[model samples]
Target chain A: MKSPLSLEPLFHVGPAGITEPVVVSWAVIALLGLGSTLATRRLSVIPSKGQTLLELVVSTVDSQIRETMQADPAPFRALIGSIFLFTLVSNWSSLIPGIEPATAHIETDAAMALIVFVATIAWGVRTRGLRGYLATYAEPTWVMIPLNIVEQFTRTFSLIVRLFGNVMSGVFIIGIILTLAGLLVPIPLMALDLLTGAVQAYIFAVLATVFIGAAVGERHKPVAPSEKEP
Target chain B: MRIDWWTLGLQTINVLILVAILARFLFRPVIAIMDERRAAAAKMLGDAEAERAKAIAAREAAEAESGKIAASRDAVLREAAEAASAEREAALATAREEADQVRASAETEMRWARAAEESAASDRSARLAIDVARKLVARLPDSARVDGFIDGLARALASLPEASRDGFGAGERARLIAPRPLTAAELQAAHDAFARALGRPVDFAVVVEPAVIAGLEIETPHAVVRNSFRQDLKRIVEELTRHDGVHR
Candidate 1:
């Protein structure tokens, strides 16, 4: 078997290589897109159960964004919700035999982090002027510019590392246990892995909302109980 | 660690595309429909409130109209009662007046009828008195009654007005009316008594008139001396009739 840390190329398109993690990510995307289409296609004023579930997921995403970011969820809902769904589905894909979770790989996690980083800058520039966005680093004093600038990259890196470490550690530990013992031995660990995957998804989404909210410089909504402290 | 730049870029693109697709298909549509439903509910509530206000106004108007109608009806009833009362009073007054007129007419009729009866009784009494006087006169002694009448004529001639006495004395001839043919001695005695009372002799022609009853009537061209039962009875009858007419 290939190393868990490295993704072998599944195939090649001309000179470019198509890796297994990328293919898995495509499948996750396709699944999410198809679900979104089917769920919203027959929306009505009165709802059936399936439509109710769809609305519940959307409202829950909106609520999380509002509580965590302290801003209206309209501008941030798509990016944050997509990141959560992709991470959750990719991570939980490990339940299928011989299928490794995509987030267990560093490349997928880095890609999602990069997206959040770029989105933060883009939203900040759009919400405040470009000068205002750059000026955010000079909060407290001019001397903190270097530290604040470093913290921007460091925070994006932290978002990537946190999700990758949790998902990869669970996958690695489960793979080692499954190799050492039989599948039964890793069952509880696998359940714990599922829980870890869902948590990681939530953390990734919430961090993205926080980063974007800070960039936008608006706290329109009320904060949650846990976030009430500084 | 090995990183594939191509894979990182591809996944980023895929996530961005997914974000776009979900925003279009799910979030925006659901939120828009929710907004529409909320607006429709608010509009329906506003319309219901307006309708309730209209219903209340109409009910109040109906109540006011009912009150006005009741007031008008009471007024009409009062006016009608007043009119009926006036009509009743007028009818009673007219009836009382008619009754009073009928009673007065009856009283007048009774008085007239009584007067006529009394007048008739007076005539009958006068006629009876005259007949009785005539019977008494016929039963009297002829010589004595004739002498009494002669003395009455003397008394009447003495009481006469001077103009009447002169008119009697100047007469070419005086007429003597008696109830019957006087006796020659009664005639001579009456003539002498009248001449002695008048201080002049009055020539007389005797007339037998039973209508004089037993007394004698001496008359000249312009003067008269009536001393007869028939004249007395006639004067009494006239006075009774005049008195009865005044009563009527």
Candidate 2:
């Protein structure tokens, strides 16, 4: 069996080599773009079934953004919604024969985390001016600034690691079982992998919301004890 | 694990492109349509409420007009009832007056008819009594009764004054009316008796009149002596008619 950690290029282009995960991400982008276009082609006051489904997805994303970020969903909807969609689709791509899920690769997870890191700063700067954004690190005391700064990079690193580890480990475990026990024996594990992939996508999107919410302004209201994450 | 910086950059670019596509195509359009739908619903609700208020006002106006019409109808009915009552009363009074006049006329006619009937009956009775007396006198010796009536006629003539007796015996021929045709001897006897009573001779022409009912009457040129049962009955009937007239 091939190492799950190794990257192999199907083709090399001049000086740079394009790996499998990069190509798969392009496919995910094309699929989402095409689906979004077709779903939104003929919008009216009264919605068709496909249009309603798309609206439901958009509303759900908006609800999530509002609940997690304590802010309007409009500014963050594209970034957070795209991340979740891409990760979820990429993770589910494992069901396709001869296609590795892009999120199972560290490169894809890192790229998604890097986009979140950049968007967090941009949103924070837009919400509060640059100086105010910088001043947020010294929040209850100036003594916490260095720790807060390190916490930012570490959290982004954690997002990358968390997604890559869960997805890649599920892929590796299913691959190992398929190698040892044959194809049908790995079906249950693949199903678990699919579940794990969906959960990881949710976690990634929520964490992005939390990080962005913190940067822009936590604006956190008190939640009921029952509503708190246990 | 090995890092692929090239793959990372490409994936990042891909994700950004996806974000742009989804935001432009999916979220913006959907949210806009929802906003539009909400606005349209609100506008429809406002229009419906306005129409409902207009309908209510129209219904109320109709009810008000109906109430006024009902009141007018009641007034008209009241006036008609009063007019009808007055007309009925006047008609009843006129009918009563006409009935009373008819009754009075009928009563007057009845009284006159009763009086006339009574007069006819009395006349009939008198005639019947006269006829009965004639029949009775005929059953008796009529010649004997004629001598009594002749004596009554002589007495009536003797009661006259001398100048009246002379006038009675003088110019025109005198007539003697008898109840039956008298024989020549009776005629001569009546003439003698009449002449003796007058102290001058009276020429009395004899007349046979059964209507005298067994009595005699003497007539001269200017005077008459009535002495018969028919004359007596006529006198009694006249007195009774005079008394009846006075009572009336």
Candidate 3:
């Protein structure tokens, strides 16, 4: 079995090597795309079971984004919902034989985290203007500017590390247990790994929502002495 | 751990593509359909509310109409009752008037019948009395009946007015009527008695009149004196009829 930490190249396109995680990510994308298209094709006011399930998923995502950001979910729904579905599907893809979960690779997790980081800044700039977005680092006092700026990057890094570590460690531990013990003995560990995969996907999506919400959320201004007294 | 930049790039592109596809096919359409259903439900509710209001208004109008009909019906009933009462009263009055007229007519008829019956009864009693007197006088001697009528005639002639006595002496023929022929002595006696009672000379003739029943009547040119059972019976009949009328 391949090491969970290393990504084996499946193909090469000139200077860039196409890896297993990247190929699996394409499959996940295609599956999600086809499912969304089919689910939405015959939508009506009166919904079927499949349409109901799809709508539930979409509304759940929208409510989460709305609650976290304290803003309209229209602008952020597509990106946040896609992140949640892709991570969830990718984490569970390990159930298929000869298919490793794309989220187990640091590269895929980092890419998703980088996307979230970039989107947060973009949304912050859109909501608060570029100068106001930059002003968030200097909040409370000017001395906290450096630490606040570093905290942004570190928080994004933590998002990537948290998802990658949880998913990759679960895969690695399950592999080690399957190697040492009989196949039936590792069934409990595999079940636990599935639970861990689901939890990790949820955590990754929740963190992304928080990071984006922080960017688009209204800044709390310090109340004056007179206002506080009231 | 080795970082693969190409895989990172590919995964980011895949995620972006997934976002685009999912948003286009799922989020936009689902939200739109939900909004449409909500709007449709609201419209249906509004229509139902409007229909309810219309139904209420129609019911109110119907109730008002029913009230009006009831009021009109009551008025008609009252009028009909009053008319019926008036008609009944008028009918009663007419019936009473007819009853009064019938009663008056019946009373008049009874009075006329009573008068006729009394007159008939009195006439029958007088005729019976006259017949009895005539039969009794006929049973007596003819001379006695003649002598009795002659004395009554003499008394009646003496009570005559002076003008009637003077008219008898003016040379008009005078006659004496009797139920039967008189004897010569009886006629001479009647003439001498009449002359003495009249206080002048009077020419008298003897005549038979069966209609005079059993009586003697002295006839002069201007006066006739009757002293007979028939005259006495007529007087009695008149008296009895008057008495019967008074009693009634």
lDDT per residue (tens digit) for residues A1-230 in model 2: 87668888878887678899988988888888888888778999888998888888888888999898877787888889889999999999998878899999999999999999998998888778899899999987999999999999999999999999999988888788888997699888888888998999999999999999999895434455688999
lDDT of 2 by residue, B1-248 (tens): 67988888878888888888878887778888877887888888888888888888889998998998898999889988988888888888888888888887887677667766676776677667767776887787778657778788888888888788768858888888887889888888787888789776776678878778767987765788889877887787787666556534
Residue by residue across B1-248, what tens digits does model 1's lDDT show? Answer: 78888778777787788788778877777777666667888888888888889889999999999999999999999999998988888888888888888888888888888888888988888778878877877898766445677888888998988877777858378899887788888878887898888888778999888778778898877777888877888888888888888888
* lDDT tens readout by residue for model 3, B1-248: 67888888988887888888888887888888888888988888999999999999999999999999999999999999999999999999999999999998888789878877877877787778778877787787767757778877888877778777667646777787887899999888887887788776667677887666666987665666888766777777778878877756
TM-score of chain B of 2: 0.57
Residue pair clashes in candidate 1: none
TM-score of each: 0.67, 0.63, 0.73
- Best model number under DockQ: 3
- In Å, residue A158's CA in model 2 sits off its true spot by 2.4
Worst 10 residues of 2 chain B by lDDT: B239-248
Give a tens-digit lDDT track for model 1, residues A1-230. 66668767789887768887888888887888888788878878777898778778888999998887777788888889888988999999998888888888888999899999999999989878899899999987889999999999999999999999999999889889988998699999989988999999999999999898888886355565788987
Q: Note the residue pairs that clash in candidate 2.
A: none
What's the chain B TM-score of candidate 3? 0.71
Which parts of model 3 are misplaced by more than 4 Å? A1-3, A66-72, A128-151, A210-215, A218-230, B68-248
